[model samples]
Target: MQMRVSDEDRERTAQQLQHAFSEGRLNQLELEDRLEIALTAKTYGDLLGLVTDLPAEHAPPVPEVVELDSKNGNIKRSGDWSVPRRMRVTSKYGSVELDLSEAVIAHSVVEIELALDYGSAKIILPEGASVNVDAFRSDWGRTATSEVPGRPRPGHLSVVVSGKTKYGGLTVRYPRKRWFTH
Candidate 1:
């Protein structure tokens, strides 16, 4: 028996077709044809046929754990860096800044473990990303999020922050929007 396809299935197929086109795997005409058929697909088989000739989508391999440490200086990561699945950041009397607005995030969820003393950690997330700090413990310090939610958003990245801080601060926020481009 042929299984029926849902709207989500059709949209996913369409996105795959678009990705193939952008990757130079499909020509403009081919993409259009596949997209039209994908949009009108009535069964899973129909949608599957559209992308059968293309290479399978594969996510980049993420390291199990990445460690970032500092003792007396600031640590900063920004501009198109690859995000690991799990990260451990340690600092003492030094601030840590992670800017993920233009990062290459492969996973749907990211875990960050922090250890700090007399320093602050600032995380800047991309749009539509959510962060949770429920597992974080700060003694003589505070954890704050600005204009971002603690729960995960649908079809968006979710960040889980955990660890301990002593006389330090943790802040998570989205990038600032610019109204004008020079």
Candidate 2:
């Protein structure tokens, strides 16, 4: 009997392909070819072939991790970087900023652990992505966010900001695009 695939399965395959591309395992041409196959795959077996040779998501050697200390001054991470499963942000007298607009997220939800002391940190995300900063707080400073997103649809990526800070501030912004009428 022939099996069938759901829309969620297709999108999940596409996301996996994108993650492989970001990890430099797949070149643009290879990624495009695999994406085409994954999106149009009819059954689970077909989709499995596309990522069979790729690394298993569950057993990735180590989560991508970036760190900033007091000496690094203002820190910024942007462009086609892969969003690790877990990220640690430690700012002691320095500011840190991370932009996830063009990033390739490995998992459905990314976790960020923050530890700031007398410094500031900001996380900027593209529209459509969901972020939960509910577990964040500052002692002397404050936390500001544009707007918390409602429950995200399936296949939507999310980020969870947790941890605590003292004498530091945390800000989260989601920039929505506006189309102007001619």
Candidate 3:
């Protein structure tokens, strides 16, 4: 699925992250790592944790929760049954959290989508799971790519968003399973 981040939310998230880094709660490396992720977070929910680390002034609070049941499951049961992956977020505009541990698939496939309209957001994937992420960025032509456990495929898969958000121009698609788009 393709996720999105809002303009107003991104600005506020940066402020909050700076506060957390300055507060001594997050070391330089930790702050940098998390800050980078928060700043580029495509979904407002992705910034949830990053924002929470900052001072209260950075991120206020909001009340909301949205969940999407797994699309399908059917792969032959692996010897072990590990918990699915989980993702959570917190930021100035609001916060959102999710647990994918239960999203295990036996064989078939599952798809999900999220759009950032308010704050920050994040995604959690299982070890063997695969993902395709195309994020929207302001850089003239900066791009990122990496190899997760599973092979990357093509399909639409989006996520919940927050605050003054805009498309990074990037979108994620599914390969093995059904994918949702923003």
Candidate 4:
């Protein structure tokens, strides 16, 4: 019996091909060819063949969950950090700031579970990235995501921000543009 692949499967394969190209494992022509096939592949086997030859290291293992816990201090993450598939953040009386503009994100969807009390969270996403806060709940707090859309964009990262906040607010926005560059 043959199994059919979903659009997500095809997109994942294409991302893998792009990663391989960035790592120098595949040349421009090879990347283009594999991407074309990956986008059109209708079966798992067809997609698997595109990345089977690449080194295993090229595909980093995604952790099940990464926890960022803070008690009295701020939790700040920025500058080329490797983003996990799922994250749980627990903070009390401290602010949480995650700047993912230059982060390495491999997964299509990133889940962020926030448990904040008397603190705020600010998530800075990269260009083309979208965020969803449908599952997020706050008590006496506010959420400001007016600068970004709530739906995910094709071929881009989608962040799902969930969990509860008390006496604190949540802010999701893109990085600020630098006016001058040297």
Candidate 5:
């Protein structure tokens, strides 16, 4: 598929990350990790990768790519092969079935927008993945590091969530890096 990274996404990610870095919210390790993610991100998939390793309570809202016309997808660049796909995860929160992983992308580093209705959310990436997310106007997210994975480990568990949060919040966690972490 074909995807285009908008100037808005680029600018937004840069500013948020710059603010995080300036505010000492990220340690040296975290700073480097985000920078790597930012640099490696070309398509939306690479940008989405940046949000994979966060805690469940801080996932940003993902836009409704499904509603977009596919005509705007998969425009082959000089050397483009694959496009990013959606990974939707649904969960039962009390009585309502919430799509927790609706905005979830596997490997992205660009800027993402999330809509939150209740609590806070965040994203945890690898050694070199940076993400910037605006969760509406109320919810906020801070950086976190951990050794645990989010989704169920019965299979290759990749989790995702975005927009219209109803309960506690959202978080995405990347796997443990045998090599390095950011």
Candidate 6:
């Protein structure tokens, strides 16, 4: 059976090439060539050549799960951490914060399931991350999201947030970049 390639697959391959370039693994010309091939790839096999010589992405030691109970303390995860395919965040009288600026997201789309009860949750994403609040239900609570004002790029990561909040607040904030910086 032939495997079809998705846009996300192409995007991820390109992103891997970009990372290799940033890490000095590939020269400018080689990086450009690989990126072109990745973006134009039509099947999974086509992307294999670009990452054949590179190191593989490693998964976290444990199942990627972040949980916060009724501890009443602040919970934070940031800086080069592996983002799991599914993230479950539950806060009872506590605050939860997730920073994805420097995170290593292995997937094109991440699912965040939040359960807040009399607490607050905040997600801080990078300047170009795409976020969608598919479903949000709050009882006497509030939810607000501020995203990067542009259509999602092909090689960008997107986040999907869902779940419920009762007497709690959920906020998603993205970085505001300067004109000089991309």
lDDT per model vs. reference:
0.82, 0.74, 0.41, 0.83, 0.39, 0.72
The C-alpha stretches of model 2 lying farther than 4 A from their native spots are 1-72, 176-182
Once superposed on the true structure, which residue ranges of model 5 sit more than 4 Å away at CA? 53-61, 67-182
lDDT score for residue 28 of model 1: 98
* Alpha-carbon TM-score of each model against the true structure: 0.65, 0.59, 0.31, 0.66, 0.29, 0.59
- Candidate 6 lDDT tens digits, 1-182: 02356787788778878888889989999988888888888765577657868877511022344444445677677786667677887777788788888887778877888888777778888766778775766777876455543345678888888888888777787754558855
The positional error of residue 78 in candidate 5, measured at the CA in angstroms, is 33
> What lDDT does candidate 2 reach at residue 87?
83
State model 4's lDDT: 0.83
lDDT of 4 by residue, 35-124 (tens): 899899886657767776897553423445778888999999899567889999999989999998999788999999999999989999
Cα error, residue 44 of model 6, in Å, equals 30
How high is the lDDT of residue 75 in model 5? 12
Q: Pick the candidate with the highest TM-score.
A: 4
Model 3 lDDT per residue over 1-182, tens place: 12355666666777777777787767889878876886777875676657554555665233133233221221121222222122222222332233333443333233333333333223344444555444323233223222343344444222322222232222222222548999
Candidate 3 positional error at 165, Å: 30
Residue-level lDDT of model 2, residues 37-57, one tens digit each, is: 888988766876787689878
Error of 1 at 71 (Å): 0.8
For 15-106, candidate 1 gives per-residue lDDT tens digits of: 88888888999999998988899899887657767876777562112345778888999989899666889999999989989999999888
lDDT of 5 at 181: 65
Model 6, which residues run further than 4 Å from truth?
Answer: 1-70, 149-152, 176-182
Q: Find the 10 residues in a row with the least total lDDT in model 5.
A: 74-83
